[model samples]
Target: IFFRSAMALQLPSELWDIIADSVQSDSLAHVCRRLWDLLGSSRYVKLNCDSHCVTQRVRPLARNVRALQVKVKGPWDPTGAIDALQHAPFLHTLTLSNMAADVTVGSARAMAAIRTAPSLHTLTLNLGRNALGTDGAGALAALKDAGGLRTLSLDLWGCAVGDSGAAALAQLKDAPALRTLTLELWGNAVGN
Candidate 1:
């Protein structure tokens, strides 16, 4: 009904902010372009799109966004995704979740991108059922360099980091501004 009708309309991009779940995979870039075109007049300031759908759509709006949440559906490609985020200059908080088993190098590169995000202070990487391994651990450990970061949440319940991964995370003691850290490894071999 309403969802279908909205999807069919050719309304101005400024009309997107009022529609919930207004993002459609095929039309993301067009909407972003319209938003950019309407810059000051457009009230839509926050965006949540399918991580895969926006991979190609993000570059145009990168400099205008304030927050971003990327949900990986299949195997993660760290380099490609992180490379896209590098264009976002005003990003504050980033949340990456629902990653698949192949998210090794991509996960690391993603963390590295967060470290360089000047305004990023809060990061949440939900790797509950993915396979991050030692490489993932090293990548996450590198985030301590993000000077503005105050909180970090790592959910590695079923990943492959094991005890060595735990050791890697323990090295974060030097992150002076990190006030809270939550690591979820309940189902993983982190204790072994």
Candidate 2:
């Protein structure tokens, strides 16, 4: 097959880029050090926060990744995954989905870490079912630091978000590049 033959020939990075999509690009980069240098630094990287090997994988590529997604579930704390943001200076798009915060302190710390990524233009936080109260919502106010953020999406459904929490999120209106905003607060208690 064309795919197998191409891999056997060890084509140049440009040819690999033309033939391989993002997911396939990851595999090609691991073929050899030369390919890794040519393609790995530019590829999008994703890590499951619950993975035992995530810390090792993230530390090496964190600085080069442009788009990063950290997804977590169950009882595992996502603090370590959020901390990875500190190393990603070139990050443009970030997604932290399905994270659970048992207290406002954790929420505040997580947002504080995310605020450090100045290059972020698009951010999606899926905090649904996390029970983030008003104080936790206040923590999201830290997003005001994302100077280049253009699109923001927050899924706080069933998180017990109230009017005051909603007010806290309103602080994002000051973000200069922000043009699109999506807030999913369906099961929360926000009054008109």
Candidate 3:
């Protein structure tokens, strides 16, 4: 009975905003496809969804996405989520939290995309499980030159980012709009 009545009401973006802000992202997204579609539309400022959602349901309507938090699984993970960055032109903050060693072959392209997103303000790459090594560092080094970024957070916990990676990050001292830098290189080979 309640379900029927609730479904009958047309939720404006305003109401969606109220519900979305109050509910947990993962739980809300799992509630049903309708709610996901409602909150995932171009109206939400911050979105938390998986790669598949980004590729299929979110990207096409991502023009308004400002802050996005996504989970990328290792090796078998799809790369379409990275490609979706191009579709979201106005993105300001993007968070790629590591659920596994997610960064592999496609990360360089995504890092490059960060440079391209003119309005991008903050970028968080938590490379906890990946073996970014020097190669990974090089791939992400490209972001140091991006002038529009206000916050750049990289968590390389256990990722083996040696001196080279550290060197790459050091170059950001001159990046234009960078205001906050959150770098966690715990359990790496930086001192070795």
What's the TM-score of each model vs. the native? 0.69, 0.75, 0.69
Give the TM-score ranking, best first.
Answer: 2, 1, 3
Q: Model 3 residue 85 lDDT?
A: 69
The per-prediction tally of clashing pairs is: 1, 0, 0
> RMSD (Cα, Å) of candidate 2?
4.3
Candidate 3 structure lDDT: 0.66
Model 1 TM = 0.69
Compose the digit string of candidate 1's lDDT tens values, residues 93-117.
6777755546675657565666777
As a whole number from 0 to 100, the lDDT of residue 126 in candidate 1 is: 80
Report the candidate with higher TM-score, 1 versus 3: 1
Candidate 3, residues 1-192, lDDT tens digits: the string is 533466634667577656655553334444567766665644443445555454565466466565677664444343565566655776777777754545663564455556667678888877776777777777777787777888988887777778887887667656788898888887778868
The TM-score obtained by model 2 is 0.75
Q: Mind giving the per-residue lDDT tens digits that candidate 2 earns over 36-103?
A: 66655545767676545545656676666777776754544446656776657777787876655443
Model 1 spans with C-alpha error above 4 angstroms:
1-52
Cα deviation of 184, candidate 2, in Å: 0.9
Q: Indicate the worst ten consecutive residues by lDDT in candidate 3.
A: 72-81
